[model samples]
Target: MQIPDYMVVPSLVVVVIILLGIAFWARYKTVGPDEAMVVTGSFLGSRNVMSEEKDRKIKIVRGGGAFILPIFQQAEYLSLLSLKLDVSTPEVYTELGVPVLTDGVAIIKIGGSVEDVVTAAEQFMGKPTEALKAEAQEVLEGHLRAILGSMTVEEIYRNRDKFAQEVQAVAAKDLKKMGLQIVSFTIKDVRDKHGYLDALGKPRIATVKRDAEIAEAEAVRDARVQKAKAEQEGQKAELLRDTFIAEAEKEKVLKIASYKREQDMAKAEADQAYFIQEARSKQSVVDEQMKVELVRKDKEIELEAKEILKKERQYDAEVKKRADADRYAVEVSAEADKA
Candidate 1:
């Protein structure tokens, strides 16, 4: 078949556009939040490292996108997600030679530093996540066993947090080499084969039970005695209250009687004073009347004496006139005889 000349240029242009789209899609790679993309091959220069001692040619991308050429570089991922491990140790000997069984849980993850990512890429490349988990579990078990061997059984059982902390701390030093770390470690339980813990609790339990019973008995006895004493005190207080009330009532009555007597005495004295004042007023009136009567009698007696004197003078004057008339008649008769 012969190709048309007018269609060749447009078809090449379309082919070029499609190739560019595919190249853009292939070169730009994106990683998830909990994932690290490690690209390693020729032409990858030295990336960020922790120290000058370690120089590695690798590019680690996490939580973002990177440009990766498809031909010369190979890109792989190591999960940054946590790995949960169940660790169990059976018939482990303690520092005091006591054999115990212990169980625990651990949360582990690959370190996120640039140097740690490079280290982890070197150790766990081309391996499954389960392989990483297995390595972490072995390391945790070894450290747990070693720590338990160094402590007593009491220390392991009672201070489980301390035990877990020591184990995690000691294991972290070793795991950092493999670019792994422990987020948390917890002791779940501890057990013994010969019933030592149970035997240790029996004596204390019996003593506590006995003491509780004794305390209950003493409380009952004391409660009864206090109840009796309170009742007796209540009765005595009631009797005293009655006696005091009776005495107060008697005193009130006596005081009322005395006040009434005093009021009556005052009234009698007021009546006597009124009578004496009336008698004195009556005596004063009688004395005034007697004085007026004596003055009238004296005036009558003086008038009677003046009347008796006037009568005596009249009798004397009449007698003197008669004597003078007799003497004059005698003289006249003697003169006639002589003639």
Candidate 2:
């Protein structure tokens, strides 16, 4: 179950009236920014405070709040932000007593001690601009000259690293009695005449540095171009070599084919020689057989001639014998008749 809120109006009225009665005891509040409790008298050493006077004082320097009395003395407002005093002096003399044109920078906020603050307040007290400048020229110039004389331009230029220490050292001794601590001091205008810095010829250095960059870029571009050309030439050579190798391979194939043909032709010649030799041997055998047949035919003819001559001689012999017998018989018959 939800419950409703109750208002205690009678109790709240009593609490408000009780708080208003305590308002007359007198609380202190800094109107602006004051962080620390105000200690009365010179801030260098005294911590002595009357409880009555404590409520009357406050330190109002920067952003924040602190306690103070609603009555008696009020808090003083000192600006805590960075401040500068631009100075131009003409009366300063170097250790060489050479007159110079000088400019100064005073980086300040607030003094650390009451004694320091009192000195700064008295020196920078209310005056017209012309009078203040005149006083700064007379008093501050010598102090600047003395400090700058101990250092050179090189030292001053490089001294920006520990500027606070240098300023503290230079201004601390004098301004300590015046209740001020300087953050830094800067000397701006050091004139060596218009021609002095130009006489060093720094423009040549800049020109040389620029020219070096251009030369480096040019060299890199030229190298890349040359490298690309060399790569192209190498590729061309490789291509030519490949073409030559292909041509050589083709020539080798042609030579191999021609060699094979020559070998075939040689084998054909050898076969022709073998066949011719076999034919000549066969022809010699046939010629021998023909010569033997011719000799046999001539012998047969001679034998036949011999047989015909023998037959004719035998017939003639028989005829002669018969004629001889006839003659004998005639003679015998004639002789017998005579007897």
Candidate 3:
């Protein structure tokens, strides 16, 4: 190790290269996507055409790395992300002379364009995020008060979106001076010392509820009427069905009675015919007996003739009685039909 005289120069050269590389690495600065690295002091003039009117020696790098000369240049980061500011203004008089208190929030951020970045660098290059937020909030509050003074409490309460727009319109000009932009402006609350908005809405709410109740009652009434009509229709249909059934039953009964009456008449006619045939045979037998008696004795023949006449009269009377009975049955059937 002590005999390396020729390697000394090469060793020193390698050490110098390594040291230079370390220095270069140390001067290399990077800016994240959410931030802009502002390099100032002894930098070349700005390349932005919009900033040509003003002489500013600064450079801004975003989402990339840049080489910074340690002795001549300094780097600062300005967040590109939005910053939220809460604004609460004292009681301000509206056009209608009503005192109103307003609370709101604003979202703002540094402009990302070349001109905007140059302007932001000039105004807030070394400032913290809070300082930018305070500046934006102050501008927003002042414009909010001015807008509120031109609107009534009712307008501020009802047209909250318009109120926010008006405030943003007025405040944006002031913020643009500092190279800031308003992303959103919102009215969180607007109130008065007295209960004005609540009193204004009470009657409207009551009217809406009353109208709803009336509509509900009308619906219920209509439902009841429809139900009653349906019940009536059902009853009418049932009554009609029962009437039809009763009429059908009456016709059936009439048909059955008529059939029975016809059967009875046929049976009666058959019985009458058989009775007449039997009477004729008895009369013939009586005649033969009388002839035999006449041959035996004249006195016996007279008595037998008288007996035969009596039997004939009795048969006639029995036929007449049966005919009267049949007529009576016919009359009763006619009366039943009429009834």
Misplaced by over 4 Å in model 1 are 1-17, 45-56, 203-339
- Tens digits of per-residue lDDT for model 2, 255-300: 9999999999999998999899889888887788777877787777
What candidate 2 gets wrong by more than 4 Å, as runs, is: 1-27, 31-67, 91-99, 112-140, 151-168, 193-339
As a whole number from 0 to 100, the lDDT of residue 339 in candidate 1 is 88
TM-score of 3: 0.60
- How do all models score by TM-score? 0.57, 0.39, 0.60
Please report the candidate that would top lDDT against the real structure.
Answer: 1
Candidate with more favorable, higher lDDT: 1 or 2 = 1
What are the per-residue Cα lDDT tens digits for candidate 3 across 1-339? 473989899989999999999999999998899888877767535442232334646677878888888878888888889988999999899999988899998889888886677788788877887788888888898899999899888788878999999999989998888889999999999887777767766887899899999999999999999999999999999999999999999999999999999998988988888899889889989999988777778766666787788887887788878888888888998888899
Query: What is the model-wide C-alpha lDDT for candidate 2?
Result: 0.56
lDDT of each: 0.86, 0.56, 0.84
Residue 160 CA error for candidate 3 (Å)?
0.9
Per-residue lDDT tens digits for candidate 1, residues 1-339, read 766999999989999999988998988889999989988766665554233334536788889877677788878888899989999887888899988888999999889898788788889988998899899899999999999999998787668899999999999998999999889999998889898766666786898899999999999999999999999999999999999999999999999999999999999999999999999999999998888888888877877777777777777777776777777777778888888
Deviation in Å, model 2, residue 320 alpha carbon: 99
